[model samples]
Target: MRFFRAAYAVAWKDVLLELRRKETFTAMFFFSLLVLLMFNFTLNLDRTQVLSLAPGLLWLAITFTGVLGLGKGFLAERENECMDGLILSPVPRGAIFLG
Candidate 1:
C-alpha cells in the first residue's frame, strides 16, 4: 500500500506538470503525425499491402512517440533536479522505481 501510494503521488505530480506545460504531449503529437504522413506519402504499396503493413507501422509510430515523450519527461526532471529529490525521499527504492 505504501509503495502504491508513493507511486501514485509521483504519477500525479507528473500528470499535473504535464497538464501545465503540455510540452511532451505537443511534441509527441506532432512527431507521430509527421511519421504517419511521411509513411503514407513514401509508401507506394497497394491497398492489400498497406493493410498488411498498417499494424506494424502503427506500432512503430507509437513506440517512437512513447520514447520521445518519456525522454522529454526524464530530461525535464533532470533539468529541474527533481530526480535528486526523488532519490533522497523516504520512499523505498522499489517504490521510486515503480513511480
Candidate 2:
C-alpha cells in the first residue's frame, strides 16, 4: 500500500542515519547506565537496604532514561531540520507525526 511504503521509507531513512552516526545509541546507553549507577549510590547499598529500594531504583532509572532519550530524539530531529521537511510533506500530518 502507498501508506505503508511511505512509512517504510521514512523509517529506513532514519535507520540509515542512525547507523552512520551511532551517537544516539551511545548517548542513550551511557545516560541510562549513569542513571542506574546514581540511583544505586544514593540508596546507600546494603543487604537490608537494597531489597526495599529495588522498585524505587528501577522506576527512577526508567523514568530518567525515558526522559533523556525523548529529549535526544527531539534534538536529533531539530539538529538536522528534519522536522521542517516533515512538516512540509503532502501526506497527512498525523502520519508524519506518528512516524
Candidate 3:
C-alpha cells in the first residue's frame, strides 16, 4: 500500500508537470508528423504499400517519442535536483522504479 501510494504520488506529480509544460507532448507530436511526411515523400509507395508500412511506422514513432520524452523528463529532474530528493525519500526502491 505504501509503495503504491508513493508510486501514485510520483506519477501524479509527473502528470501535473507535463500538463503544465507540454514540451514533451508537443515535440513528440511534431516528430511523429514529420516522420509520416518523410515516409510519404521518400517512399513513393502505392496505397497498398503504404497501408502495409503504416503500422511499423506508427510503432517506430511511438517508441522513439517515448524514449525521447523519458530522457528529457529525467534530465530535467536531474537538473532541478528532484531526482536526488526522490532517491533520498523513504520510498522503497521498487516504488521508485515504478515511479
Candidate 4:
C-alpha cells in the first residue's frame, strides 16, 4: 500500500510536469509519426508479407516510443537536478525506477 502510494506520487509528478510543459507529449507525437512514416515508406509489403511483419513492426514502434518517453522524462529530471532528490527520498527505489 505504501509502496504503491509512493510510486503513484512519483508517477503523478511526471504526469503533471508533462501536462504543464508538454515537451514529452510533443516529442512522443513526432517520434511516433516519424517511426510510422519510416516503416510505411521503407516496407513495400503485400498482404502476405504484411501479416508476417506487422506484429514485429508494431512492437518496434511501441518499444521506440516507450524508450523516447522514458528518455524525455529522464532528461527533464536531469535538467532540474530532481533525480538526486528522488534518490534521497524515503520512497522505495523500485518505485522511483518505475515512476
Winner by lDDT: 1
Candidate rank order under lDDT = 1, 4, 3, 2
RMSD of each: 1.2, 2.9, 1.3, 1.7
| Pairs of residues at least 3 apart in sequence or in different chains that clash in candidate 2 | none
Q: Higher TM-score: candidate 3 or 4? A: 3
Report the C-alpha lDDT of model 3 over 43-72, residue by residue, as the tens digit: 888999999999998888788778888888
Model 2: runs farther than 4 Å from truth? 1-12, 45-56
How far is 48's C-alpha from truth in model 1 (Å)?
1.2
Candidate 2 residues 24-53, lDDT tens each?
A: 778877887888887777767788888887
For model 1 the local lDDT of residue 10 reads: 91
Candidate 4 residue lDDT tens string, 14-67: 889889977678888888889978998998978899888888888898899999
Model 4 worst lDDT window (10 residues): 21-30
The best candidate by TM-score is 1
- The C-alpha TM-scores of every prediction are 0.91, 0.67, 0.89, 0.83
Clash pairs of candidate 4? none
For residues 1-66, what per-residue lDDT tens digits would candidate 1 score against the true structure? Answer: 999999989989988888888767888899999998899999989999999999999999999999
lDDT measured at residue 81 in model 3 versus the true structure, 0 to 100:
95
- Which regions of candidate 1 fall more than 4 Å away from where they truly are? none
- The deviation in Å at residue 26 for candidate 2 is 1.5
Model 3 pairs in collision: none
